[model samples]
Every structure is written in structure tokens, then in C-alpha cells.
Target: MPHIIIEHSASLDTDFSQLLKSIHQSTIDTNLFDASTIKTRRVAFPQCILGDGKTDFVHVQVHLLAGRTQTQKQHLSESLLNTLRTLLSDSVSLSVHPYDLDPAIYRKN
Candidate 1:
């Protein structure tokens, strides 16, 4: 399972719903996880200070069950970053971080 969370500055203008759909689809294209298990959400911060206080940013964090190869994780992150690059403006600071959940401790009810 993978949970994708997008955190962005509120000033950033974009369609979050469409972004989620595109991200979900990109995850599916990887053939790494079940389509039904992919989850995506967004959070916007109304106030934040960035470099010079003028730059807006979008950060995507992806959490997944452990045990995937490093290459796979990198691929996942890069795929998402590429997707963001296409949907967002070049002026926006974008980043993607892929985190691994320990299989022994991670659980779902």
C-alpha cells in the first residue's frame, strides 16, 4: 500500500483533485501496487515563510510498505516529480520524498 500526501502553500493555484487522479494513475503505471490501494490527499498551508518569502512550494510525501528495491523507490519518486513538473509552474519549488514503512510495525485494521 502507498499513501501519497501533497502539502503546498495555499497561494499556489492548481486543481488538487486532478492532481490526485494523475498521481494515482502514475502510481498504477509503475505496476508496483494494487490500484485500489493507492490513496492521495492534499493539505494547504495558508501561511508559511519561504526563501525571500515570495516562493511558493509543493511537497509530496509518499509512504509505502517496506521491502521495495531502492531503484523502485527512486522510480516512484521521479515519476511523481515528473508528473508535478508537467502540472505545476516552473516557478514553483517542487519536491518528492518517498518513505518506507517498516513491514514489522506497520498495520491496518
Candidate 2:
């Protein structure tokens, strides 16, 4: 079970919707989380203050119900970023965070 939260500035283009869809697909392809359990949220950043230089800064927080090996996390991270870069403009910035669940809770019995 992995949940992804996306926050972007209001100035960001509407194309971001497509980007989110792509992210969802990529996550499903990874087989890291149940597609049905994946939770996503997109929020518009306040425009009063200038955004952090880019149309938006994306923070991808992944919560893995099953503990992942280091290699698995690395591969997932790389794949996620690559997919994001392909969908977003070069000017946009992206950040990803992968969290591994505690073995006690995540290990498959």
C-alpha cells in the first residue's frame, strides 16, 4: 500500500493531470503496491507568494506496507523520477521520498 501526495502551485499548467495519471500507471507497473490501495492527492499551492522558482515542486511520499530491499528502493526511485521527468517540463522540479515499512509490520508472513 503506497500513497502519493502531489502539491503544485496554482500557476502550474493543467497538463499536470496527465502527469498524475502517468505516475499512477508507473506505480502500478512496479508491482510495489496494490493498485486499488494507492491513494493520491493533488493540491494547489498559494499564489500569493512566488513558487520555489518552478511552476511546482512535487513531493512524492511513498509508504510501503511491505519492507523493500535497498536495491528495490533504489530501482523504484530511479524509475519514478525518470517517469516524472518525462512527463514534466525541464523547468519543473521534482522530489521523491521512499519510505520502507518496519519489518515487524511489513514482512510477509
Candidate 3:
């Protein structure tokens, strides 16, 4: 399974739900996993908490089951980042990070 967790500034007034759908579709297009197995959620922060007050940011963390090649991971990151940039305003800083989930430690029912 691949879970996409997005964190963005609460001040952002973007169409967040559409953004989530685009991300989900991008992952599905890779054909590495079934559409049913892809999950996405977004969290908005009240403040940057660790950055300059005037700066807005959108950060996406993609967690996938282990065994994907490096190329797959990079494409996943790029696809999501491109989607984010297109949907968000130029004032917002964006970033994407891909992580491997350890099957031995991850649990789902």
C-alpha cells in the first residue's frame, strides 16, 4: 500500500480536495499498485511553527511498501510535486519526500 500524507499551511486558500485527488491519480497512473490500495490525507497547520511567519509551505510525504526501485520513488516524488506546484500559488514553497514502509513493522487490516 502507498499512503500519501500532505501537510500545508492553514492560511493557504487552495482547492485542497482537488489537490488530493490529483495526487492519488498520479500514483495510480504509475501502475505499481491498485487504485483501491492508495490512501491520502491532508493536515493544515495553524502556523509554520518552524519557519518564517510570512512563508507558506506545502509538504507531501509518500509512504510505500518496501522493494520499489529508486526510479519508481523518484517518479512518485516528481509527479506529486508537479501537481502541487500547479495547484498552489507561487508564494507557497513546496516539497515532496518519499519513504519506504517496512512490512515487518507496518500493520493494516
Candidate 4:
């Protein structure tokens, strides 16, 4: 299972609901995790600061069971960022990171 958390500044506000949908779908498109097993959430900060305030930023963190190879995670990150970039403006900063969660400790209901 994989859970994707999207964090963005308020200044970059656009269609966040649609952005979330696109992210989730892109995660599925990676074929690394089942669409039904994917999870996504977004947090918007109203008073967040970015370097020089030249542009807003969006950071996506993917937490997955500790088993995926580097190549798989890299592909996932690249694909997610590419898809997100399309839904965002050129001035918006974007990044995607993947973290390996300890399968033994990651408990779910």
C-alpha cells in the first residue's frame, strides 16, 4: 500500500480537488500500487514561506511499504511530478519524494 500526501502553499491555489484526483490517478498509472490501495490527502498553508517568495511550491510525499526498488520509486516520483506539472502553472515549484515505511510497523485497519 502507498499513501501520498500533498503539501502546498495557499498562494498556489487553483483546482486542488482536481489536483488531488490527478495525483491519485497518476499514482495508479505508475502500476506500482493498486488504484484501490492508494491513498491521498492535501494540506494547504496560508502563511508558508518559500525561497525569495519568487513562486509558490507543492511538495508531495509518498509513503510506501518498504519493498519497492529504487528504480520503481524513481519512476513513481517522476511520473507523479510530470502529471502534476501539467496541472500547475509554470511559476509553481513542484517536487515529489518517496519514503520507505517499515512494513512491520505500518499497521492498517
CA lDDT of each prediction against the hidden true structure: 0.89, 0.72, 0.87, 0.89
Give residue 29's error in model 1 in angstroms: 1.0
All candidates' TM-scores?
A: 0.92, 0.75, 0.91, 0.93
Clashes per prediction?
0, 0, 0, 0
Question: In model 3, which range of ten residues has the least summed lDDT?
Answer: 47-56
**Candidate 3 lDDT by residue in tens digits, 13-109:** 8888898888888888878888998999999999775454447888999999899999988888898888888888777888999899999999999
Which portions of model 3 show Cα errors greater than 4 Å?
49-54
User: Can you tell me which runs of candidate 4 are displaced by over 4 Å?
Assistant: none
* Position 69, candidate 1: lDDT: 95
Which candidate leads in TM-score? 4
- Top-down lDDT ranking: 4, 1, 3, 2
Q: What is the lDDT of residue 59 in candidate 2?
A: 59
Clashing pairs in 2: none
Could you give candidate 4's per-residue lDDT for residues 1-109 as a string of tens digits?
Answer: 7989999988786898899999999999888887888999999888766675546889999999998999999999999999888998878888999999997788889
Candidate 1 lDDT: 0.89
